[model samples]
Target: MTRYTPALATALAVLLPVSATADSFTATIAAGHPPVFRWIRMISDTFIPTVTAELEKSGHTITFDEQYGGALAKVGEELEAVEAGLAELGTCQSLFDPAKLAVQNVTYYTPFVSADLRKVGEVIDSLHADLPAMTEAYGENGVVYIGAPITIDDYLLMTNFPVESLADLDGRKIAAPGAAINWLSGTGAVGVAGNLTTYYNEIKTGVYDGVLVFASAALPGKLYEVAPYVTRAGLGAQYAGSLCANADWYEGLPDDVKAALKTGADAARDWYTTELETAVGVSLEKMAEAGATVTNAPDAMRAAWAKGMENAAAKWAAELDAQGKPATEVLTTYMEAMRAAGATPLRDWDKE
Candidate 1:
């Protein structure tokens, strides 16, 4: 009887393999920010379906465990959540993950860098292709880097007061965080740490005179209602965000799955950029229609603001060096690469 039991168990174990022949895989994706517009919807509506369709053609069924609107994580926590495997993949905002993603901050420091989305996209692809250290950084956090270059529209200042000239900005409270604070320093505009999610309330209560933001986000946030003066400084553009995957999970995927994931990310990047191109123009028009004072920053104002950012680049490098990392080298490499890519950068930040 015992021998029969053993034989039966062995037979059942062998049958397990045959029984589980279904070719289905699950992908868990999370985004912390609310379901606002282009960014969040691109992943949900466009990228996921595109990847799923492609995967199906390869004889695999896919399921998405989507946790959008912060169901899985809070703002600034998406990457960390993905790192912890709370979700399989996610949108990681480098602007928020400063410590772990400082090298990614290269664009943030070098303002007026480039507004051409195609150029920005090419640079990002090149950066991933060239910078193993960036991959290493992502790896350190238990995630694999996937390039979905986020194209931020030109940065602008929207205020309650009409800032016609450099002198008009004097003594105003400007909401510009990180290296952006340097853009407002000595203009008598005090710098405050702020993001799009909170700028409205900040401006409503007079916490800030205006914000250093782009119309793409600012209009949707209804910031124009609070601060009607919109100044287009056109501080070039930037690679604002990225998509990443859990390293262990991503590395463990079959080659086809890996390819599909990349395809999905590329699609997302393309769709998001295209959508943003339309949105930026539309948002500006919307703001104007809503009675906002839209105008360009005076040449002297732009020059004065650019000059104010002189010390910040050096300050960032020194801060990074004091932490015992080769911050200066990273900064230089990025600048050189940008110039090689035909970007005539305004600030030589590495030496600043």
Candidate 2:
């Protein structure tokens, strides 16, 4: 064999692209919820694979270590986990972490706006992409907002007692998650702060008379077993959160790698919205077949419920505005987008 020389090695290096060596990367993705949830499922079934495939095209490979079901970070703590590098990425749930993601919780405060999950997802995802204010909180929290917005389906009231009208809700205790608790205002019902983790058990044990929950989660959590009276109150779909990456780690990645990550998130968003739409119908049907009474609230009652509620959006935005969080901007942008998309709200939340 010929003797090795520095000149020969240098020439070989110049002839080959650095990527020809195939750099490998390891990413740990975290989610508070388990794989059974569609958002988490999207991370595993779509995001990781899409990113891997894209990276492979550039002679790079990535392996994902998925930590879900609060294995790595509990609900409301995912952003902190990713920020601190406990995981490289996570589903930063705004609904649960309202203090940190105040602007992202705009949809939750602006109930009765739209029940279309696709519209809500599209508007919120677009806001994240085009609006700096929408993502400034993420930057401040040491995370970078990516795509894959988690859009919950239209919320409804499920209770053990029959709710025929607003009168039925008088003095009743209803549980709602995060800012959604404000939704019970002027309805004569007592709003209790709660989450999906405890909704079913709480209702069964007389802790809550009902829960304002979504169809996608309600069916899986088996809320129907305890709260058989399903009243479609039209609380509207909401933007709960999105995927985020550790700012420090993400900034250090190569441009190509960064691009791959975003592409994966887009794929996840599409997959999640599609799956959620189908699941909404399936969940409702399955729950009804299991002996739950599913009834749509009359138009008059729906309008009255919306009109009578306190203007939580204005109040919430004002509170965050005092904190310098651009909450009002987010609310206006979202409401305007929804109206442009053909949604006629019972009340103009931003205008009021």
Highest lDDT: which candidate? 2
Q: Write down the worst ten-residue block by lDDT for model 1.
A: 14-23
lDDT of each: 0.78, 0.91
Error of 1 at 87 (Å): 1.2
lDDT by residue (tens digit), candidate 2, 1-352: 9788999998988889767787889989888898888888999899999999999888898888999999999988999999999999999999889889888988888888888999889989998988888989999999998899999999999999998899899999999887788888888999998988898889999998999999988998999999999998778999989999999999999899999999999999999999999999999999999999999998888888888888989988998999888988888988898999889877899998
Please write out the lDDT profile of model 1 over residues 179-277, one tens digit for every residue.
Answer: 677777667777788877789998999888898988888887999999999999867677756888999888888787788888888888888888888
Q: TM-scores for all candidates?
A: 0.87, 0.93
Worst 10-residue lDDT window, candidate 2: 14-23
Q: Once superposed on the true structure, which residue ranges of model 2 sit more than 4 Å away at CA?
A: 1-21
Give the clashing residue pairs of candidate 2, or none. Answer: none
Q: How large an RMSD does model 2 have? A: 2.8
lDDT of 2 at 298: 85
The alpha-carbon deviation from the true structure for residue 213 of candidate 2, after best TM-score superposition, in angstroms, is 0.9
